[model samples]
Target: MQTEYRYITESLAINDYGSGDRELVSVNDGPGELDELFQRVGFYSASHDFRELCGFIRRFPKIGPYNALLLHIQRPGCTFVATAKEWKTDFNRTVKPGARPLVILRPFGPVNFVFDLQDTDGPDPFPEDLLEPFKIHDRSREAECRYALDRLLNAVPADGIAFYPSDFSTAAAGYIETAGIGSWQKFRGHQLKVHYNHVVSRNLPPVEMFASVLHELGHLYCGHLGTVDKRAWPDRKHITDAGIKEFEAECVSWIVCSRMGIDSESEKYLADYLDQNSRIPDISLEVILKAAGMIETRIKKGIPVPKSMKIS
Candidate 1:
């Protein structure tokens, strides 16, 4: 039996996390309307992904995803940013007099003002490799693929999800099963634990291998595997339709891969399914988009060290 967790809100709100000029509005429109609205999530328009969203995300890995986006909205070319105090103490840099500070929402606190590297004058104290590890650059096509696979392998252990080697290479490349919690991850509302085993093959191209992990993560984020922490994402495990699960995951794979400039075969899989059914499967467009956004944010720079692993 799956737990009936608090799922995606039936109602959608189109407030720009403080970046939009328009006032917030509640969208009570059905799937079609909200579906259209969700795609319009770009501060400017839907086609904005061709711009700097991914680069902005990769450049500011220290801030929470929402705040990083807020920073990008306020200043698109922002480099390293630190609080006035942090700039002075950690970086030995001082904010230039009269430099207007950029604001980001402080976690559990009021707003915080942080100065970008451009606004600061300081003795360079960072090691040569300071952010080199977190940057997004490709040495070659093959290197990018290898990095994708390696990053996913290293990144999953943070969430208590372990991946093992496999021989198969298609999207059904792996299986996910509960491993029974070996330990507790950082508790949010309550003590939450995940011991998930995902198996994927290394025989495929890097892009295909990467999409396979994305496909599997699609299931976890969609609540098909059940929720370890609803605070991170809603758990809709009670949605017991196999087709819905596959459809949602496929949609997520398509959405994330498209944004990352990687082509996915999931598009063909989805198209074939739709053509055969002659109608869209009953899947939550909201959840599918949300899952893609989450995954893309994490991988936009590269595989990210989860928030849990960040401070652990």
Candidate 2:
């Protein structure tokens, strides 16, 4: 494959993905949602937290020119200034005029999620020409989370076994592997002991047990919790984003239980959870796909999920 090249600000130190070392290329300019994102967040400065933010984003494939984009999202930023047609026509005219914008919504500060926009999928090729701007939400996502959780918990079987609440902190939710406990291998084997002690208390209703078990199952099945590194996380908490982990797990659990004829309450909780947590009114297809990965086996083959036994 021919490598695409783009120029990043000298300060950001972006990896060169393509062949050329050129500073800028407007080769595939187009009118895409990514362009709209750029118009939303405009121009970076010499010193901004964006440097760190870009550093994080650049690690992923299909992501480039993060520093420049981060610069545009920093404080004292102009919203929709850089991405407007005026700037796109001038700076990004080299690309196709009608590509769908690639949008990534990231959390910023205490209670806001910012949507970072980009045009090209792979390399920026024209990092010099790319512009970014900030768009902030003035609220918390707690409500959405509660709704999603409620929906997930309400949909499971209530008669089987006791369930315990895991003592995982919110911070640990980000980098969790959804695959499951088995994936964590040695690290989880030990950590589960500690978490088990903290969370396991009394016999829980089968449905509740199912919900909690399903939640962890979602973590494992989705490969989220399994990917955690106990030492690397802050305060021994998992390093993954909490909202993403919880929401995805909940989405998976809810849908799966729903398919298995678990109960109406599970559906109610899931509906509520979705209602309260999602920033956008609609659920994304990615969420659906992740959820599907979790519950597909149980629904298809009627596999009995794991459970804790009660002592007489």
Steric overlap count per candidate: 0, 61
User: What TM-score, computed on C-alpha atoms, does each candidate reach?
Assistant: 0.51, 0.29
CA lDDT for candidate 1: 0.58
**Where does candidate 1 have its weakest 10-residue lDDT segment?**
1-10
Candidate 2 structure quality by residue, lDDT tens digits, 229-293 = 21111121242676656655565555444433344244455456545543322212222233343
Query: lDDT (0-100) at residue 19 of candidate 1?
Result: 11
Q: How far is 36's C-alpha from truth in model 1 (Å)?
A: 13
For all candidates in order, the CA lDDT equals 0.58, 0.32
